[model samples]
Target: MVHRIHRIHRIQTLPVTPDKAWDFFSDPCNLARITPPWMDFRIVSGCADHTYPGQIIEYRVRPFPLVRLGWLTEITQARSPVFFVDEQRRGPYAFWHHQHHFAAVENGAAVRMTDLVHWALPWYALPVRALVRRRLRIIFDYRQHALERLLGRAEQGEDACRA
Candidate 1:
């Protein structure tokens, strides 16, 4: 077996209270809303409520043409208005761990999302590393853009009403 490790850090600014930010970000179903519809990502389960420790979220995503993939992840730790950690229970990766953190900043709140994932193919580890690295970057970029759009919409609604 081979080991490929990846780490990503992203910071986002949102003009919302910590509770509100946590409420929006911690909802697993909101993930479907943020993900690009072209990817055909759908929540298979765990959309009933907000996250909690040991809660599992299942997803179906068509990342490539005519190929659908299933991912199962469980929340390892959860602390409201602070942070939570989730790891893959079963999925494409051999190992996947992600930590989501939130904090209050000057104007609103700043969110720090990090992922420490390690994955390798059954036999072809080297080539898989290169391919997976690029894929992870693209996935995270999509997530960042989606969060920005959500925050932008919330801000705009606030501005419109105030005008």
Candidate 2:
């Protein structure tokens, strides 16, 4: 049997339109700004500054201390102001799929952002699932805080979280 791991991040709502939220998250260049610097994550090739359907991205990443791995991912889907999906083609992991979703709040003054990631390492690497899960959370936590600083609240700074 193949083991799979799934993780989801429901980030705090942002006081912005779906289109605004989508624009920031969809831009490939914004990744580095939001990512934690200690990971030493850097884009190696494949339009790291642009994003489009069928776009391929290559990156040099350090998942562990002094451990660097090359990762390649494809933008399988890209729809403006709504969602996008990226899947791993060549990377350290056996499998990886990530979905980014955005929805406007009922009041239309805020947007909700969500990230769902599914991944699996090699068969022999099953023992690292716990560690991987923990690390993922930490990574996402960093992203959440970054977004909050960027578009977390409106200029009015009202509490605009969704109901």
Candidate 3:
């Protein structure tokens, strides 16, 4: 059996300060706010108000009808108002590494947020790879719109990001 790692890179600029962007993303509790409602995402345990190295955040998510999965991810790196990295410790994926980066843009008037994810499905899931990729795109697309609503819209003429 062979496994392949897939990557997704997305970037969005919002009309918010860097601190505000970092504050919202660094807290595990706000995840549900930005995620699509259909995912039925919820924090199960091991979550704190703020993220830190070695912080384990557990979640229960329903990706399909009448199905539930436990996802556990550890914050391996956290740099305030800058970037954070999380890696999966257990759950659906064969591997998952997600990085969230934030930077001030437009001379501190706005924030440019970047999401880079590296993930792979278990061998058994290989047959459904296309479906998985499409599902992920839908999830991230929902997230982008949700964030704009929660945080604020991007500046006019700003480049939109797609997964």
lDDT score, candidate 2: 0.77
1-163, model 1: which lDDT tens digit per residue?
Answer: 4364555555555556778877987899888877767779998988856889989899998876797889999999989988888888887766677887776665454433333444444444566566656766677667767766776423322111000
Clashes of each: 0, 0, 0
lDDT of 3 at 114: 93
Model 1's lDDT to the true fold? 0.69
Residue 149 displacement in candidate 2 (angstroms) = 1.3
TM-score of 2: 0.86
Best by lDDT: 3
Order of quality (lDDT): 3, 2, 1
lDDT winner between candidates 1 and 3:
3
Cα deviation of 42, candidate 3, in Å: 0.9
Q: Model 3 — which ten-residue stretch has the worst lDDT?
A: 154-163
